[model samples]
Target: MDSPHGAAVKAEDFGLKGPRGWAFRGVGIDAAPGSLIAVEGPSGSGRTCLLLALTGRMKPTAGHAEVGGHQLPKKMSAVRRIAALGPVSGVTDLDQALTVAEQLREGALLQRHYGAPVRAMLRPRAERRAAAEARIASALEAAGLDLAALPKGERTSVRDLERLESVRLSVAIALLGSPGLLALDDLDLKLSDTERAEAWALLRSVAARGITVLAVCSEAPADALVLRTGPVDPDAPDAPQDAPDAPVEAAEPAGAEGDTKNDTTNDDTNDDTKGADDALAEAGRA
Candidate 1:
């Protein structure tokens, strides 16, 4: 079945409340095929939670979401099959003891074993190994990852690699499965300007291949569809004010709609901040 976005994700009136408070309330979004929709907000503004909900990793308290033509709960398995999530939480998903090539090979084998029927699974072991190896190479190349550059090349242990390399490995693993919808969280959290630009280019390339990308970021990219949220004015009374500016402010949505295009362009060109890049390079070199 076709997804709400004609790709593989749809959320309507989705709400999630945590122990602290509501992460997102009455949030609704749709992503069409090949489109990149970005969710922009402050650190604690429920972007990650929303992403989890839409991806079927977390159930919502209210409203509905669909992935891959199946209603959330009813087709969760199917949704998972076609959706890939990359979250930056400092926790490596790869097995630290395993080499990069081993990790990739294992991922491909597992995907095949789970995705195919009993008959297909019964195929000769040699053929299966050949197919898995091919998939691993393709996924790595697509993500611009060069395992051979490591100290031990493809044999390099995950634990020995730099944080950025590990992150790239996770991205390669996610791409190995070829999911129709890709959800990325904190993509530019601590990367250098050059690294972030390269990452953005990689993401754009993935989207160009007809995948829908929904990412949560502190700042939105130039071509992203931006969505923002902020604290509601508690001191200001809800009652209508006589001031003309008050009416205009009330009429406009959060973050100001008129600034969308300008903000996008500004974000694209605002590369003056070299401090972040310096910090990221330090981290990468460490």
Candidate 2:
């Protein structure tokens, strides 16, 4: 991987509504390509939904956004092609059963099959195989994952690896596509202070390589661009303060398409599950 090109990300008045209520609204952000961006918020603040929507995995009800010059929602499919997900918990989980090598090999195969350029695919079988191998190696290097560091080297099972290793593996897998944007969740989960520092360093290195990185974290890094998320307050001076009872939504899929059939502004139903559920539901539509 000679450093995949990154995508510029921009959003304005971006918002989403679920059956329960608005996940987030009036959101604004601007980041250059190859920038390291941190999405900061509490558990149910719609951090995950914003990640999904920007990557073309979810839809927004109000406002608009662009990733890599492609408008969101309308160009979601295109964004999906340029964006790859990493460690999104419920959305993208590693198979605990697979060995490290197996996981990397599987990712390589998927990228070769679905994301390969026509010219590359036209190469001889052996050349193609070598190319995939090279790609896997490059991704592993870029992700700072060294197989020899594992107890059993390439044969180490995912379940046996530390949380940080798992994140590295997921990131490597996402890099197989050499995507313009890489989105990850829970960047600081289950890590000590030292580990968290190392994790941020890894992300910085990735961004330096020209891949825009969107990471979700409870604590925003001091150096990276930060995007904050929180429960939307309808009473905020800037919000529809007239809506006295608009409730903030929690983070969980309540059902498919949170009240897509209804106006999300009627979204003040004080339900949290609906937005997450709606995000999940709309994600499938992508």
Candidate 3:
């Protein structure tokens, strides 16, 4: 059961244009809570532009989008409050010199300051400190990041962390404010295969806990709903194979040693085909 009021992102006929030309056109999608939708395309294929539009960071030249029931203003401040974007470029907002704990504390304080009523600021110092600490702890746990493991525990500088660790820390900071939607771009850009798998697993766990996630990638996991983009006539052969100035390479000899090797290997495999089939049948039934 999805929350009717949960973050439901809808983009209708979205389009964007830059100085050169259109970045994207006629893009439409509806993402509900708990859904993992992937946008897949080649480089310079407008994937990032579509992401920015959906997240409310950039407005579409045509059509409109709504996130968590809030329409994007022609401004950034309003959008900043409802969603968090993790860029594929791995640029976390964490201060390089600040420890993980300090970053979390600052994030909570900032959220409270911005979201708090003016009179709440007038409360006693102890009360504010307690409230901030509670929020930070909850957020860190929810993000699955243990600040205590850092070199200086919560006091370790972000500059000391490995790339993956830094990404996790950024996600923790984003979770502190309880955003309605989380958008990740270029999730596999620079990560190793194993690291990328770990990152995807982490994100799926986050989605299971009820955060709406939309990611952009050149390739996506098997379970993701894929949105693909490419040239309109993808199979058309546009290159001229018979152009007047084209170069040609000589063909291999008919009775070459390579042909003999392939024929011998094929004959040996054919002789074992019956035994292999029987083994495969037994394995399948068992």
Residues 1-286 of candidate 1 have per-residue lDDT tens digits of: 1121326566676654333334455666676677787888776556655665565444455567776676864444455566666543422256888988888877676666555447757889998777677777777776678977889999998889876676678777766666777777777777888877787787787777777777778888989876664442334332221111100000011111121111000000011223222222322222
Off by over 4 Å in 3: 1-5, 72-79, 87-92, 229-286
Clashing pairs in 1: none
- Predicted model with the maximum TM-score: 2
Cα RMSD, model 2: 6.2
Ten contiguous residues with the weakest lDDT in model 3:
259-268
- Local distance difference test, per candidate? 0.58, 0.76, 0.56
On a 0 to 100 scale, what is the lDDT of residue 244 in model 3?
18
Candidate closest to the true structure, highest lDDT: 2
Predicted candidate 2 versus true structure: per-residue lDDT over 19-134, tens digit per residue: 56666788798999999999998877788777876776666667789999989667666777788888887666788999999988988877776776668778999998888889
Those runs of model 1 whose alpha carbons end farther than 4 Å from true positions after fitting are: 1-8, 88-92, 229-286
lDDT of 3 by residue, 1-286 (tens): 1121236777665655433334455667777876677888775566655665565444455556677766643422344455666543322345787777777777667666565557868999999888778767766666567877777787788889866677677666666566666677677777888988877787786677787777788888997766664432223332221111101111111111111111010000111233222222322222
Alpha-carbon error at 285 in model 3, in Å? Answer: 63
Which candidate model has the greater TM-score, 1 or 3? 1
Candidate 2, clashing residue pairs?
A: 19-258, 249-272, 250-272, 253-277, 254-277, 258-278
Q: Predicted candidate 3: what Cα RMSD to the true structure?
A: 20.2
